[model samples]
Target: MAQPQPIPGTTIFDGIQAAKGYALNKMCFSFNDAGNRAAFKADEEGYMARFQLTAPQAEAIRKRDVLGLLAAGGNVYYLAKFAGILGLDVQDLGAAQTGMSKQDFKAMLVRANEQVIH
Candidate 1:
């Protein structure tokens, strides 16, 4: 797949602007805050449980491997949601957007969901 170039003037802030109605900033803030991180870590299993992911799916998330997460059936939207939660920058999002074909992206989402059921 041809890699996607960054959209000029685009930044994580742009993503935040695009996500105004989605509470993306709130999620990002929660994920970026040290206090929240500590709180999340305190009950990691429970938090992971909310995603209803299998062990390997959860493991993949812990590893922060985008391809692996995608291969395991995670939707890009949701993955993007998680990425936002992780404070992933727009550059990372652009890289992911550039990395695969549309069909491949759909397949990755299916695979990610399938893995979560295992």
Candidate 2:
């Protein structure tokens, strides 16, 4: 089956993207192990090299760019592990996505939930 046309401004986490992201995602997955997370923190470049990330993926990691990582074929759930290493939670990623401050994005989330309840 033909994969759908790429979405404008979005990198779909389809088979192709998954293939492209294998090394990157593998690296992120390692974060599940505390020792691996410490290794990453201890030597980021070395860690990325160990995973054999591509130039773009490694660049995204070096820049601490969530969006760039997504564009480089990172899956959000896996990327959260990477984010944790930087002391950023999923909410921080949400704020980045919405171009809002963390506080503002959190407020938006609360407001939206309240609307759904009332």
Candidate 3:
């Protein structure tokens, strides 16, 4: 059998990633609560310490590096909560993931939608 080709510029969220990101995901999930979001904003370092995040995960969070967080095994679903805490939305993440400016990313989305609709 031929070996499967991995998708370029994509991280497969498999068992290894799940295991590696358990702590980070858990911390992000906590952001679903308004109080938790406020707490994180008030004491970023202390909140991350409370979650016992790995060094890379903590650093990614500190830097607001969406791609780095994904590379460090963060699930986009969970990370959305974290993003919301930082006043970001899915469009911001999409732009970051594609390395496009927000305006360009939105334009691309419109173009793609037009293709599908027409």
Candidate 4:
């Protein structure tokens, strides 16, 4: 059987990625709790240490680099919690991922919505 072609600019969150992202995703999941979010805000380094995040994962979290987080195996769903802690929404993440200005990304979404509605 022929191997499936990988999608360009897309990372597949397979079993390996799930294992790799376990720590990071777990930490993000903790953000569901207000106290946990406050604790992370209070001591970013200490909180990451508690989660045992890898060097790259730690750096990505510190930098708030969405693409880097994804490359490090972060799932968008879990990352949403992290983004919430940073006062960002899914549209912000979409803009960052697409390399588009937030305004442009929002405009694109509006256009896409219009196409479907009309």
Cα error, residue 84 of model 1, in Å, equals 1.2
Could you give the C-alpha RMSD of every candidate to the true structure, in order shown? 14.7, 2.4, 2.0, 1.8
TM-score versus the correct structure, for each prediction: 0.43, 0.86, 0.91, 0.90
TM-score of the candidate numbered 2?
Answer: 0.86
Evaluate model 3: give its TM-score: 0.91
How much lDDT does each candidate structure score? 0.55, 0.89, 0.92, 0.93
Q: Please identify model 3 stretches exceeding 4 Å from their true place.
A: 1-4
lDDT of 2 by residue, 7-97 (tens): 5656678887898898899889989999999999899999999999999999999999888898888988899999998999999987876
Better of 1 and 3 by lDDT: 3
Comparing 3 and 4 on lDDT, the stronger one: 4
lDDT of 3 at 7: 79
**Residue-level lDDT tens digits of model 3 in 1-118:** 6644777887778778999999999999998888999999999999999989999999999899999999888999999999998888999998998899989999999999999999
Ranking by TM-score: 3, 4, 2, 1
Q: Rank the candidates by lDDT, best first.
A: 4, 3, 2, 1
**Candidate number achieving the greatest lDDT relative to the actual structure:** 4
List candidate 1 stretches off by more than 4 Å. 1-42, 94-118
Clashing pairs in 1: 72-111, 72-112, 73-111, 73-112, 73-113, 74-112
